[model samples]
Target: MVGVAVLAAALLLRYAALEAGVFPLDCAGAAADGIGGLCAAKWLLVQSFLHQRLGWLSFVLGLAAFATRRRGLAWAGWGSGIAGLVLYSFDPAAIGALLSLLVLARAASQRRRGEEQPGEEPRDGLGVGGLG
Candidate 1:
């Protein structure tokens, strides 16, 4: 449930950021430079790659992770999400997406381990004391 919501948010943010060109222009620089801002060009060339390309990639992965329950898929999603988040700090959508993927991965791992040793009981805090 939460994962789905996070994934959705990430997708939305990525689309909005791309469509708005939110990364190219530094707000402070733009304000100082006015309409024909050199800062915009500088920022665009420097930041557009990650904001436009990698951002979309991350969003796609997040969406896929939300739709699927596989551990490997979740890890991929999380990795992309983290990369996107690190690159784009203005939006926290990627962070949420990453969290969802992490949760899914943990659940999947636990489930797999449980299945591998179905008959065995889980170990408690106490150490083994029996001597052969």
Candidate 2:
């Protein structure tokens, strides 16, 4: 999923930009100090990844999945939640991941039971043009 890939990139970037210091963290002074090659942009992203921003984002995705019952939302919420825990945003991320799992499980069960999506017509030769 795109969310998973984004988090993975963030993890790698954190390793490079923050842990390895491949680029200076103090990029607000980039222009003044003549730093080049997107250092300021990298710094801005790294800052957002700190301070539980990802945790809140995962939680919101979980809430959206619960409200909409969409597998895409659930997958994003779950993956981002696990990534958030690793990225230093634990509690909310854990809860959000659990929520996403529950939604996925329910969806899987509905699929097994031949349930139709809300507002969707059944195509088993019972409606519309009699799809046999």
TM-score leader:
2
lDDT of 2 by residue, 1-132 (tens): 555686777678667656776775555663567656677666556565677888888898998998898899999898888777767789888788888878999888778877765876556425557535
Best by lDDT: 2
Q: Which stretches of candidate 2 lie over 4 Å from their true place?
A: 1-10, 30-36, 116-132
> In angstroms, how far off is 90's CA in candidate 1?
4.9
Q: Show the lowest summed lDDT stretch of 10 residues, model 2.
A: 122-131
In model 2, the clashing pairs are none
Candidate 1 residue lDDT tens string, 95-132: 43575466586676777756544564444213554455
**Candidate 1 TM-score over all chains jointly:** 0.38
The reply for model 1, stretches above 4 Å from the true place, is: 1-51, 89-96, 99-132
For each candidate in turn, the TM-score is 0.38, 0.63
Clashes by residue pair, model 1: none
